[model samples]
Target chain A: MISFDLRIDRRGFSFDVSGQFDEGVTAVFGPSGAGKTTLLNCLAGSMRPDSGSIEIDGENVYSSADGIWVRPEKRRIGTVYQDGALFPHLSVRRNIDFGWKLVPAEQRRLDPLEIVELLGLSDLLERMPSELSGGERQRVAIARALAISPRLFLLDEPLASLDVARKGSILNYLKRVHDEFKIPMVYVSHSVTEVVSIASHAMLIRDGSVLGFDRPSALLLTAALDGSSVERFENILHGVVGESTDQLTTIEIDRISISTRHQNKNPGEKVVVSLGANQIILAPSEPNQLSARNVLKGRVKEIWSSNGKVFAEVDVGPEIIVELTESALNELGISVRSDVFLIFKSSSVDVFDA
Target chain B: MSSDASIIVLSFQIALVATGVTLPVGMLIAWLLARKQFHGKFALDVFVSLPLALPPVVVGYALLWLVGTHSWFGSLGESVFGSTLAFTWIAAALAAAVVSLPLVVRSFTAALAGVDPRLEVAARGLGSGSFRTFFTITLPLAYRGVIAGALLGFVRALSEFGATIVVAGNIPGRTQTIPAAIFTRISAGDSDAAWRLTIVSILLGVMALATHNWLLKLSSTVSRDSSEVG
Candidate 1:
């Protein structure tokens, strides 16, 4: 666990934050230039706060009042930067073991071989950083961080620089690492999908201040309500593959079968379906002859209105959220506990392996 | 030793020593200039780059004032070396280093500036001390420029004339480098030796420049490959 109450005063901007991070991945989500990186830097001890204190598991790492600033090397924290920052001169093996060798022999908690296997970096051991692909380099970066058995891990959008395909694979690998290591982490990212996929806890930050911090599922709802730069609300539904055709795949969620674009999966295989909240269309009842392939009935569980826009969560076997204008809601006379048909194109559901 | 061999050998020795002295100092100044912020930083920048704009003879004159028999360093030089630093081989080497230092510092600064400081921060966050991070990350990444800078210094030191003449004087087989020896040959109407020394100096210049370019090409190819992978 890591806790900090810090303030940074600069000529252009000031940052103020107080929070505690627990076990598992805590995604710090916000738009660009949100002082997310500055917060991480202060925690890493690279940037000292103008005033206030930081403690890692109750050990005070920095306190301006006590003049007890610890050097970054002594902080026992690991950081994976957005750019992968592997040592250009060292081989993958040496880079991964760079920090591991520094710790006393008896105190080492993780094995180099184990990390190489976990991150799938066995073949890259002899390769130079310059010779590895972006994904491979990031894997090596994570492996190197894990080698140190750090007290806490800080990841500043490790997948931001990768392409979509690479991002998906890397996200899966990150989840595996987090699950295996169980170290508390502060993962900074601006992507909503990434936060939903990996983070158990979420911190909403904007303009150098902590907006809210809690479970991702709970905090994101409030974030959508606030409408303060947390753009593009997305809903992730867990389901299982049921039937598939060349053009269509049906996913069974509880008692409902929802169709999506063709997915390469077998029956009974677990999958996750992603649909943007803005993509869902709601009607008072099922409309005939619609081009949309999926339509299910559900009673509205909750509805929050702001700025003439209504965000409603509907329970149709698997819960779905739909964002609509207040005018449309008024016209349809929809309210909480009202039965409604949620419709969306099959192509809109992006299915990924769980 | 023959005049030709003596000129060639002593010139190389002086250049080697000058480059050796300039490298570490140049890298230190370059790292500071690239990474730090402090009062008088601009003044320091101007001071470090002054030699590039000033004439070599002016540097020689300043060296003469500092190391001549009239100052504290001069007295130390006298006691340590059994003579004033002026008109000595050591003074020739010192003069060459001063004239070439700006080139070393400039190349090093540019190289250091190109490196991402975030890499160093990441290293520190991974439990690496500042010194370790520098040697492991910063130095290796900037080595191409560092070598290029040293080659430039060596070439400049090898051809030094104005400053060496002012401080080291034209003592054959002692402080008479290639340029000084060329002057000596041409002054005595020995056109053949002058022409031969001229050819040697040209060849040396060409070789040093070629090496510098080759190193740059190698560094670029490696960087390009790394970026492609990235």
Candidate 2:
């Protein structure tokens, strides 16, 4: 776990950060120049914050109130710089050993042979830094950092300097590292897509401040999806596997029964159901030979009118609202304290983890 | 006249000989000034460049007084080698070294400062300490600057005039260098002979400037290329 209430003054730009990351990859995502690297530096003991506390895995690495600040070397936090900062004169093997030698014999944590093989650096160990490819150099850099057996790994856009193809290859390796080791990592990146798959917890920063903090799955389909519409989608889910006849791949979310729209699903395999007010159909009595697969009976609890249309609140045990056009409202005569039936085709339901 | 060629030839001998002798010590001092910040830096900096600012007559007088026949250093030299530095080209070279100290110190310091502090920090984070990092990363990288300092100090040594004349005493083919030789011919009112030696000194200077520029250009080119390729 890593936690800090770090406040660093950066030439008039102050970075005030206070958060905790227990395990897995906690992403520090924000626009460029949003104090991402500065925060990482503070945690690494490279840049001392003007004031505040920095605790890593329950260890107080830096604390201003008690007048404590650990040196970078003593802190044992490994950093992978944006430029990789590998010693240009040393070959791959020597560069990796650079950190291992710093660790005392008893404290030495990593097996060099495994790291070399894992990073595919065995063949390139003898080659000078100038001879390695960009991807190869980054792998060596990662191995070098890993060799130290750091308490916390701070990666400052480790693959930001690479091209698209190179970045893809490196991201795969990063995912493997994150999953296999379960190492506490503070991943700094600007891309939303990059953090989606791996980042279990996220801190969204903007203008040198964190805007929000939550799990990645919840954070994504939230407020920032559309600026102009501001249409709050209640993480709407409704769908089913319409193709397969062997089983009903439909799910019931409230009054809506939903099946897979395009792809077929197994029987009762947890499908999401999107319950939109507009798709609901109301009938006074049982309707037969109707294309709709669902017929739910309910009493009209209340009638609310808005935006040149009428909305009826129907009590279907869990309860839901259905929207009707003004003309349809006149024909149905739906009003408060009136009995009504809700009929809708299961195909009308749109389901996605969206 | 045979006198003129021999006089011109003596200047080359002095410039080469002095520069070769001072090169190593000059580089070491330059490195010192560049890397280490001591309590008495201003004093040390001033002391190194004092020979440049002070008149050569003062330098010669100081050297003469320090190593004169009355001084223990001179007496020791006489007793040991049966020779004195007071009237030799070696004494002239020492005088030249003092005057040329600033050149080496200035160039080396600039290059050392240009090396990134973060690179050194990275080296330490990688486990190399104060001394090893300096010798391995800082020194090799600052090599181009050291060479520049060396060449500048060499050129400065070549042009030694007043101190060389006063200490080494303008002995032809012995202590007399090109500048001293030119002084000799000029004192004889042989303008053509003086001008011939002057021409050789000018060529040596032009060659130093060309070499310095070429070296500077090449160093910059190599650094730029390496960074880009990396």
Per-residue CA lDDT of model 2 for B86-150, tens digit only, reads 88776777778766777767777777776766667666555556667777778777778778777
The lDDT of each candidate is: 0.87, 0.71
> Candidate 2 lDDT, tens digit per residue, A1-354?
878998877676978888988777887877787788888878776677889998877788788999988777777777777777777767889888888887888877777787787777899999877777788878888888888877777788887788756765676677766666667888888765555555678787766677777875455333233211112222233333334444234565555544433434454544444455667888877788887766777888987665455667788655666767778877877777777888876655544321
List TM-scores for all candidates, in order.
0.94, 0.61
DockQ of each candidate relative to the true complex: 0.74, 0.24
Cα lDDT of model 1 by residue, B34-143, tens digit: 99888988998888788789888898899999898889999999999998889889999999998888889988898788677988888888788988988988988988
Query: Each prediction's Cα RMSD?
Result: 2.2, 10.5
- Please name the candidate that would achieve the greatest TM-score relative to the true structure: 1
Model 1 vs truth, CA RMSD: 2.2
Q: List the lowest-lDDT window of 10 residues for candidate 2 chain B.
A: B1-10
| Model 1 residue A220 lDDT score | 77
**Model 1: CAPRI class:** medium
After superposition, candidate 2 runs with Cα above 4 Å error? A53-61, A65-69, A180-182, A219-354, B1-102, B109-118, B162-185, B188-214
True contacts kept of each: 0.85, 0.21
